[model samples]
Target chain A: MSTQSTRLAARFMVAPSVIVLFIWMIVPLAMTAYFSFRLYRLLSPDRSGWVGFNNYVWFFNSPDFWLALTNTLLLVGGVLIITVILGVLIALLLDQPVKGQGVLRILVIAPFFVMPPVAASIWENLFMHPQNGLFAAIARGFGAQPILFLESYPMPSVIAIVAWEWLPFATLILLTAMQSLSSEQLEAAEMDGASALSRFRYIILPHLTRAITVVILIQTIFLLGIFGEIYTTTQGGPGSASTTLPYMIFKQAIVAKDIGRAAAGGIIAVILANIVAYFLMRSIGKHLDA
Target chain B: MARAASPRRRLLTTLAAWFVALLIFFPVLWMILTSFKTEASAVASPPELLGASWTLENYVEVWSRSDYPRFFWNSVVISVGSTLLGLAIAIPSAWAMAFVPGKRTKDLLMWMLSTKMMPAVAVMIPIYLLFQQLGLFDTKIGLILALMLMNLPIIIWMLYTYFKEIPGEILEAARMDGAGMWSEIAYVLTPMALPGIASTMLLNIILAWNEAFWTIVLTTTKAAPLSAFIASFSAPQGLFYAKLSAASAMAIMPILILGWFSQKQLVRGLTFGAVK
Candidate 1:
């Protein structure tokens, strides 16, 4: 029943976003690919030339690259384990008929709203600082030495901060899924002599499977590029102990002024992200048809 | 579902819940509390919970002594400007997809979402070099456009999901009344879509305001937002607990309040409406 003009109008309406996003995706991506093969250092422009595969070979063979790869995996894996486990427990608790639910919910979700720099500063200064930090105070009260958390356990410290930022996200999604579970099914299970643990494991956990997958897949995408936390807290140091892929790229481009190498690393980051995004798109695609 | 448990059990559950909530919220609560304390007391050994000589000096110092207000203004302009710009672009696109039912609309949307999945670092060198060439580096206009592009996909996805819920029959009714396209959208669609628009705006604003990556990376002193401003303190000065708390609290409090209101939309918008 729709006429030609309506269809034309729809095309006109959608054009700006499509065009803007198209350029946004393709132009930078093309430039990155182009630069990866060129010897373009911001500092030494006179030295510029086509480097071919040298940049990628150098980036892949660097010690920092391996350290960053391991650290990135550890950071992503660590935060996922922490957030998902704690998120499930927290979500289950929030789903209970507890008083002050509104305040409790706000309290739990507050960390997610915090900017990364602020969150890093808070933990780095207020709680994780070896001298005046609260953890130090507690250690002293127990007649023990205060550990230099960032120095001694840089990856774990970074993981903790990032996990704090994302815990609420996982909890919120899982809790939403938890609330949608039909009570009648749980009641029937209870009547069949299933214990509380069995009911949760058999009933609630299975119901939350999709939500859990969403949380893991989505969080993995964000966590894979963890930069601000590392930048503000460790600067990917005492050495390359905490340098993830994004931070490594940042150091390469902004600090070292090595555009060619950073572009190479950037392309690698894209490939790594696309793998996770492939699964994420599939899951979201499933929802589209339903 | 509302069947009463024993009083003891209920009390225990409440206690457990509150305890865990506080434990999770402790860092934020401590930051807010420390913001009121004198610098010396802020780092007091065997840290005082409430016994510290509370003062408003840190807030005053953070606000007045440094260029705090300038960074705050930059954050405001960038987040709000980008969101408004994104809304202008997204509303029409989302509206068309929701109403027009073109064969490729789903693919288009998925593609838009895929753009978001491209890691920001993937194009860092290009964007940085482009910004330098275009004189957009370390400027408010530059930051605004970057954040806007960063968030445009979410804005479209959220609006598309919202607009999809408004029945086609309503539009058909408007058409039968002889309203033209512009008039139908102006008179009928805008009013119905306002709430959804507002929710999307709020959520995107929070996202833009708290966005740390581009804001920190792309700007120096002139255009640095609070995120970058706070990142400056990562060195020795960050050890000033009271002042750091004050600055951190000021940077996050507004979005925290906004976030509580938009928690529902957060799930829907972030997961691309898959969970909901």
Candidate 2:
């Protein structure tokens, strides 16, 4: 067969998967957009009639909506702050010529491999248990009151747990970018009496900007849908302190069985995530094309 | 001129780095240590690290009380099954996109990736309703399909990147020699890209294994994976600390071992194309 025919065959082979992805992406999202304007609760299916924009109004009018939106922003912002700073620091540390570097790298990445539910459970049970947790025990030994991490500061606690999971990813990506820096440049800086801080700030940070963008983009995609950690850790509990958009959506749809309101909430969450993702994609697209 | 000061600073930096690494690893170590302690010792006031009498009772009780083997097998089936199915679909698609470039190839790839950016919960209700309607709510196959679809984009993206690294001339050479498309991809392209393919498969398996949302929501008792198994111990009233740790250990051990062995490949795969 000629190359043209072979290419045609390849295209034919690829079409099905592409179509599947397209339908998978479009249908549910269209349903979500449609339901956002309707009045359809799962429990009250018979009484459900068209109440256009009422669901969205009801959702936006609720104080819980604003609270959940704020929580989502805080969760995303807080986790990003913690992960990026620690990621760069750890990336710099791991980049040095040190013994057992491989093991240390593994130790750092191990948390990322851990299932979120299991990680959250471990943090809650083994690390954050007020009675038997390591932190509690250490606190008592130091003559301090045992701090209930999730209970007292639900959002920050969730943020910390998630940061632990995501920091390695940022570190790995940034470290790869760091290793690509030409050693000659660093050597030149050193010969010119450039201090460590100067070299890092002037040379290293500039080199890592693209990698940082990629890390932030990728991590935001995952963080926007962060359900397991919040569910397993706080269940959005202690009076909905840790309930982010995704958690709120889950509770509205699954627990409350208010499908229309949940659908509206889902649409809002998608809009919020996409707004963040749009900027991220632009940066990533520039980096990829460059 | 500054060698003496540089050496001292280097030593201090190395010490600080090790300290931070230890701090990050401390929780996992603590969990493992707590697993070996008795319930009383695990929760002891002083939090004895090395002084507690080690016991295997937690592991034994955890194993006996739950069908751990079933959960383990479920996890293996779902993760491995999804990964294999994903690769089976992704390889051909990636091969086509990488070699047979068309006007819309990049657009198609980007479109596929954009699907991943949508929050899973946005579709959660519809999927749940569909699963219930189709009678697939609590089955291994349901979980497998969900995970496969979830990870397919990443698999295809990684494979596309890997496939792009291979020179197109190599496949052209095979085609010129009268080899068919199947032979060109199966016998030539695949063997050359085996390492990349292997790493992609490994990473996808880990992702599928670690997935918690759909697994927890979709499965109940029969097809619940280790994530669900560990979560069952989180009772509001129960204080099963030792057993919880043991269950956690059991849940994490497989992936932990996998991560330990494949850390190099994982790091490389995750950072693929980022530096370049």
Q: Candidate 1: which pairs clash?
A: none
TM-score top scorer: 1
Local accuracy of candidate 2 as per-residue lDDT tens digits, B129-242: 778898889899999988998888888888888889999788778878998867876899879899888889888889899898888888889999987766555745235777
lDDT tens readout by residue for model 1, A1-290: 56899899999999999998877778999999999999999898899899889999998899999999899889888998999999999998888889999999999999999999999988998999998889999999999999999999999999999999999999999999998998889888888999999998999888888888888877887888777788788999988888998999999999999999999999999988887677666766464443
Per-model RMSD to reference: 1.5, 2.3
lDDT of 1 by residue, B1-276 (tens): 444578898888889999999998999989999999988898888899768899999999999999999999999999999999999999999999999978999899978977888999988888888999999999999999999999999999999999999999999998999998899889999999998999999999998998889988899899999988898775464347888889899999889989999988889888877788
User: Among all windows of ten consecutive residues in candidate 2 chain B, which has the lowest summed lDDT?
Assistant: B1-10
What are the Cα lDDT values of the candidates? 0.89, 0.82
Q: Pick the candidate with the highest lDDT.
A: 1
Model 1: lDDT equals 0.89
Model 2 residue B275 distance off true place after TM-score fit, in angstroms: 4.0
lDDT of candidate 2?
A: 0.82
